[model samples]
Target: MSSSSPSLARAPHHDGSVTYLGPVPTRPGGSVRLRVHVPAPGASRVRVRWGQDGEPRLRDLTPTPAFDGQWWTGELPLVNARTSYRFLIEGPDGARHRWLTAEGVSEREVSDRSDFVLDASDAAPDWVADQVAYQIFPDRFARSAAAADRELPDWAVPQAWDEPVVAAGGPVARQLYGGDLDGIAEHLDHLVDLGVTTLYLTPVFEGRSNHRYDAVSFDRVDPVLGGDDAYRRLIDAAHARGLRVLGDLTTNHTGSGHEWFRAAAADPTGVEAGFYLFDDQGYHCWLGHPSLPTLDYRGRELRERMYGRADSVVARWVDAGLDGWRIDVANMTGRQGGVDLTREVARGVREAMTRVNADTWLLAEHFFDASADLVGDGWHGVMDYAGASMPLWWWLAAPGARPHATVPLPIDPLPARDVVATMREVHARYPWAAVTASTVHLDSHDTARFRTLAGGGEHGGVDDGSSDSGLARARHLLGAGLQLTLPGVPALFAGDELGLTATTGEHARTPIPWDARETWDAATLDAYRELVALRREHPALRRGGLRWLSAGVDHLTFVREHPAGRVLVHAVRPRPDGAAPRDGEVRLPAAVLGGDAADAVTLRGEGLVRLDDGDEPVLALPGSVGAHLWLLPGDDLAWT
Candidate 1:
């Protein structure tokens, strides 16, 4: 339970790598080979304690013939739906026993809840981990000429494409810019050139607000966004360019104007009334927002209408060509007061979607700890804001800055060690597949833009191409590098690569400045493009297991290990004196660098120099906010 050092030396390490665990999507009821690396002789013996038919079972691990004396190998029975296991390492003379769970090595007995889990239920689609997703807020992305002809709803306060976005007051949600699907279809080449593999569009259903979380109907796309035909065109265009498209769905609640809500409010005695919680006082709304009415999943009719049936909303969308869905407020879905059908709803939706298309990638939007909900049967993964974004925000945030209004509590900048620890601890709770499939992003439609958080412009302020934006842009690229290289699907908010800045979620919805190329931050855009390309080209960054190497105050080093190859990542921010840090030396096992005969390493990005002509590798870290990814050479076992 105490803090664990991030250093690789003397640490027992295990990840989802093929070297550690074999045959991803571990076979049900089949023996799976597992390995653990104990770099030092701190333990005389090691054993794997796993779950079996409601009881605990132990199996001895023998030392592998290679990697000198660090590697130990064993096989897990995989008898349960979710196989939970941890290592029991005995010190010399069987003293100072240490338990190694997903949380790291603990000297005392620890909770088994943090134990590494291998789900025998189902894995995410094979493509989920490999995708580099780009998220677009529908109304703010772009507006085609065709969009100007469409009539806006009475609730809309239309604005020109170049007008300032109203980031505050009640009018913020009503200021619509009329971006449509056709507009997005026109920009397919931009996304392809940026090297993103998937396009994640925010809700397109008929909604009252510019953000569209408040859907009035699930049956069709908003007419103002060029209707269902435009939607088809966008999907076809994206797919033609080898990109997958995902849609957002709000399952936790519906806009008060939704047809189902209207029907229930009009007739209390009707069958539609059962779809929501209706008491004598009034109906229950999500988080007390009257405009957004929460759904009650206790009744079978609501379930059948949402996702339980072949003709349900969930199935209809997949049939319409959505590669997957990102369920909004999924943590609150089906759990209000005494009724709790969250799990059942997730499983039902997954079943319904897969029936239409087996490869559908389902993701949940959970802002807080989502480990308990990601057991592999329901959502393929979560947005991972709690594990990835929140920690990275603290690490990259400027002094006295907060993430956004939604995250009201103040978060001071975190040291690299604490950030790494937070991320490691939170990720340890998820099944390996869930961890890999989760979205790793800096910001999203519901949060402040990363550039603003890193001290770019005023909170919610638009980009002005000012010199003050340099710090924000550098830190933004630093975080973007981590997002792309981490053990998850990297997602880039639409305008983040273009140096966008915002103080809050509403302000963050500034329209993409496609026409104003001169105002763009070309350097930032190039960094994103290069990073995305690196991730796509290297198997280690796309589908590799992560191993922490070292964590310093201003720098972090890790290695992504894949069977085909290995990559070393070193990320550093500027020192207090604004000089490049020199103490970035991290010694790896000789085997990790291909034992003495390792091939030459290729460096990407700025501020890393190889001084490895001597004994071990020593790196000169970046003088500014920068990152370096080294393509390492190694064989399957010894890396020689």
Candidate 2:
């Protein structure tokens, strides 16, 4: 895994990119062609070791002449629902060989758990790879003039658009900024301008709080957020602007005030009573919170009402023009104590949504490790906080300001190598389709702002003046570049690009300040625009396989390879001690780049200069906070 040697960089790379592996989502009993790059001074013989009929089998792979002798390939039958395989690179001496698996190259045998996977059930919608998503907290995004006429519920404490957010103490959830669906519809132009293809609203169902995770009803939109009619209009307007909208649903529980909970609490013999778990003690609430009642999937009636039937909540929303659903607290949706119905609930949701919209996306919000539930039979993708966000946070966190509350133990700053290692380890656990479909974010509503982690001060609260510092802006933009260029859908929480800051998740919900353009971070916004445009402009960034080129304490480099192109990215982080930055150099292997240094061309970057040393191209890294990208020629790199 060391980047000091070019041989390590060329150590037999393979991934599920269409350019490398295919017949994607192979059917049971079908054969799939698998390929791997074997650097020059080729292996004596290359073979694929796969699990077949509960036994390990090896099949020889010959040099793929179409790839100019640098690539080796063969076929393997996917006889099981989930087939696991790895490459065996045999050296000239029969006694020496290397195992190539998802965990990277190894001289000794590794566990099968690290093997590359192909699942018959894992197929994401083709459109997923091309999306850039924006997350919106509805209450703080924007509000239309119509919101003024609507009556506020008893739980509401209304605030002006320009009023300061109350992050703590009194009525955090009750303080409504009056942002409604019609208001969101009116702001479609801003999304289009931002170059996002999808908009993800946190929960929109009628709830008792401004942050509508506690839903009082699932059948209708909150009347205060302009009702069901406004919801439809927003979806229509979004679709017209070529933007897809995803709704958030809390399948694990509902507000204690929800009609089903209300009905069940009133009558033990009622059909709705079976929908919840009750004992002599009382009904179960999510995380023991009295205001949020948990749903029991053991009851068939609850399943039918939630997602089993055509009239179910899952079906109704997808049918109502939601392009997809972002299941809230998805990691805990179906299990309580010894009972576990997580997969069942996921399958039910997927099936119900598919019945109404075949292309609808089913994404889960799992704050930690979610590999056990990402078998592809259920959610197409997850929020991927564990795989992408957390690692990035550790690498880029400000000194003494690691604010993620989920981690039970304290975490110190991580080196760039550890960051890439964590990402690879987590990403390897799922099928390639799921990996590509997942969302990569820096921060969300559940954690501290990424800006705060990148040295924007203690918190991103509106009153937190650190949000506007030059160093914070530079580091924040660097993190954004990394997010967009990675091999997944890049999602931006609302107001992040505007340089909005908060000390915690609740405080991060600062209004967009639409009327106050002067308050916006114009530089950060412009950087976001440039980064997203770059991602959309290149196929490699959007739909490619990643290969790490180098990793150091302050510099991380990688390449994204696709049939259409190849992009090499080098991200540099500033030193925390404010010392002069060192020059980090990454060498590009000719075997991997498909040619000599003459073929590589610089795209756009800061403080970077390319130096060619014969067959290998060396990238002179920038000491300051910035990201550089280069386009390597792909004409000779194409595979059949």
Candidate 3:
């Protein structure tokens, strides 16, 4: 079986086709084997190139007699923090059609012109772990009623809030809700009060719609949302308030109206042809969506212009004091069987970011299994949607939904044991130091609002609809408490803290009703504040290993063990009906319930409570509809 045979089973490819080749415990100046799978036969020549910027280095592979169809491996000498490179399958007559490039090039194009390989030593910046991110949808956040309402820009038409979010043809909802960067700057104090350390803005680059995901120009900020100066001012204002801001970067595709796309569409072989996937019939769009045309990263000039070179769009933004970038659709970057473009892009981004700010964070928006993509020294971390968050939602909100639930009616809450076990497995698989920076949230712009999922009200309905406010608040508190106390970072969507319930998509993205603060349910906010304060006060809750104490269908309790000198016992209950009071003593692990050796414990009616013993404290088990976070003191003890 030659390497080109498609039937041959190949080893699973790493995150983005890049491989880690070195001693298990890597040391500086060591040597390792770099292996890649090429499924082609009759390959006479294989060429490899390795070097850093402004340097030429080379190597060639001799064919192994009767080579198996499996992976074809190569050896390379390792040097600390050096940008090395390699390419296999050189001649056009060879059967092999695939090879890995340090520059994320397509198989057809492999030359010295490609960008430099990423240095594996680069990791995600430090600030990412300690930061709290707040996502802002520009249009829906806040409107400056005082400022003149600008006319609808090109490719955008104004419509009422109730209108559908269709494309250019339909009655599109494009009303200028007036929320701009200046408005965001004006409300920095409010963000500070909410304890946000980072502001993750939706794409502010030049675009037509409210959501700027369909970018027209990566270099320019949208004039409707404020221009480059406005962005800089916003960044400055946020910095003044001790906040960091990261702009969204959409690299997978661009708007059809983008200059590059327009040029490519006009002439198939134009200068911009390499920038897009153009054929006789215009440029290739994503999923046939005319508005978004995919970019062809195979072109050396395109990669260098967009991601390479000091003056590249990515580098330019970082140089402008932008904290970092949130890469959109990261998993979709690489071409099939070619170098993982995302890894290459991430490398360029990392280099550029480190050059600008060593503490800059690189957050990728990947909505799939990200363990491989996030690890392997490619990115700091992706938006963690799998490990901690999805499970919680499945257990709490859509329990009756498939895979987890077995019966109809109200499904049983996710077992506390299962939650802890899943958390443990995820932690074991992805250590906190390596892949812990995650944006844990109930909902974002992509999904239905948390309140609506919690059965607060019907979609497209008025506020008169009733909600399980008290029950929902309790659940929200429990979720928020766990989120804050968990190992990874936590993110709270705007208006979620104030218990803003939305029945429709537009409602979910509506501006924060500051006036409603006095009238809206503040229980969620209060609980979040308390949890945040608790997390801040206790080192254990901030950074600690979690241990499950007791868990059942109705009640769940766990403890956070900190290395410093603190422990926190947290508990939550779902049953609305109170637990029957047990007259006999309830024995608990001394680490959890830190009181005199009581053989039996008494339970009151339905409510949550926390008991402090010496410095250590225990959160008493809540009977129904409540959550408790108790601060504990003294050395951590093992719990069974």
Model 3 TM-score, all chains together: 0.71
Which stretches of model 1 miss by more than 4 angstroms?
1-7, 24-28, 91-95, 459-466, 575-600, 606-624, 638-640
Rank list by TM-score: 2, 1, 3
* Of candidates 3 and 2, the better by lDDT: 2
Q: How many backbone clashes does candidate 3 have?
A: 11
Local distance difference test scores for all models: 0.82, 0.82, 0.57
Tens-place lDDT per residue, model 1, 261-310, is 99999998887799888888798998888899999988899999999888
Top TM-score prediction, candidate number? 2
List model 3 lDDT by residue over 1-640, tens digit each. Answer: 0011112112111111112232221233555455443433334565556663456556764444221222335655545444446565544374444454432224575554332233345455656656777888887666554335665585666544333333223433454555777777777887887777889887888776677777778889877767888889889999888888887888778887788777776776688877776556865666678788877677787778777778887788888878888887777765434545767767766776676667777777765556556544556677765666665665555333221111224434565556655554453334243444566766666554565555454342222223544555656666776677665667777777766555334446656665445654556666666666666666655545444455444445555544344344434445434343221112232423232323222211233334566444333444434455554443322211
Model 3: lDDT to the true structure: 0.57
| lDDT of residue 113 for candidate 2 | 83
The 10-residue segment of model 1 with minimum total lDDT is: 1-10
Tens digits of per-residue lDDT for model 2, 390-442: 88888776766655677544447778888988988887788888888899998
Error of 3 at 555 (Å): 4.1
